[model samples]
Target: MIPTTDDPIGDNPALIVIDPQQTTSESEEAMSSGAASIPGGRDAVMENINTVVEHARSADIPIIWGKELHRPDFADYGAEIESCEPEHGIVGTRAEQFDPILSIDEDDMEPAEYVIVKRRYNFFHRTDIEHILRTYDIDTVILVGFMTNICVHYTAHGAHEHDYAFRVAEQATAAPSQDLHETGLKCMRYLQPRGIQDITDITARLEEYDGNQLVKRVKESGQITPKTGPV
Candidate 1:
């Protein structure tokens, strides 16, 4: 929930965007094939996520992107193929790369803006993501990504286990159906009751965060100077 006063999301936050790679082109191809798509288009959901990413950038928050990269032979996918993506897990294919809107180069992604490539749904599973968050001093993680019932859900649980606060960008994650999407959010809320949040509310708080950073910068510089935006 957003605060009536100051909000932690507006300051020193980390935006964890998971698997924003599936594009409209891929979705179209999936429809032609036997695979099913979650309710509400993935493209629309990613648009909301991009808005959050830009705001988080302005607020100087770390943006950690997770890309699900797996071997073509399905050696690293384990049971993931049996459940989902049996037809969808090939690498170097057209759908493998991130979409242009969420493209790394277009986003001006820095080396410091961490990108986690994982063979597992949970970013923390056998990954240094926990240590990475600690290095950045990321207190809370604002999550937005694909497969609400799968990757996003497990990642939220991972955040809980790691003792990091998390918020779900409800409009920013898509499942195969509206029911499953809501169910995923409900499950995440069960882990952290107040963690689920609307993208609109999150964006509003991010806008307010600009002034918060400005104030702090002035105090440190001892004079007014132009901000290069959040570091």
Candidate 2:
């Protein structure tokens, strides 16, 4: 449901952008069929990702960009390394890079915003995300990014298990097919009734984020700065 005037996404929310670097910016058509393929098109989904990111940035919400990086020798990928067709997020490959469409380091972007690298489908596994969230007292997680059925789905599960109230920008995430996309949303919704919502609704809630006055405390602890002002 689209949140009405009052937003339940909470005041201490962090926007977790899961693998926006699914493809190189040069391959626009990868949205249809490729290792980077994302159903419902690529550019539009990416645009939504950026729009929500900007909203978070403007409202002092934390933006955690999850990058699925693997070792060059594939030793860290586990058994998938020996699979005939393995995950494409191998560290040195273009598939593991941030899409060129993203402005990762812009003047308007906050200096404290993070790019977190992980090897598992779930961000919480072997990543500093939980510690980071705890450092900032973040209790709410809003997810947006590529492959709704894969990384996004598992990350939502991780968030749920971690006891963080989470929501997924349903329209902001995509999969290789519409079936998978819808199924992914259903799974998340099953886990948390209000977990699936539109990006517009999510951003509306995000615009209300004022750092809950916790930003200063976290920064003093050397954890992270709550975004404020123009960034």
Model 2: per-residue Cα lDDT over 1-231, one tens digit each: 123223546547888988877553444443332222234466678877888888877776667998877787778888656644345676666876677777576344354478889888898888999877886678778888866877888999998888877788876788766777778888988988888877778877676656644554444554444464785
Tell me how far the alpha carbon of residue 6 in candidate 2 is from the true structure, in angstroms, after superposition: 8.7
By TM-score, who's the top model here? Answer: 2
TM-score of 2: 0.80
| lDDT values, one for every candidate | 0.69, 0.72
**Candidate 2: segments with Cα more than 4 A from true spot:** 1-8, 22-40, 81-86, 106-109, 216-231
What local lDDT does model 2 show for residue 137?
Answer: 74
Q: List TM-scores for all candidates, in order.
A: 0.77, 0.80
After superposition, which runs of candidate 1 have C-alpha atoms over 4 Å from their true positions? 1-11, 23-40, 106-108, 210-231
Best by lDDT: 2
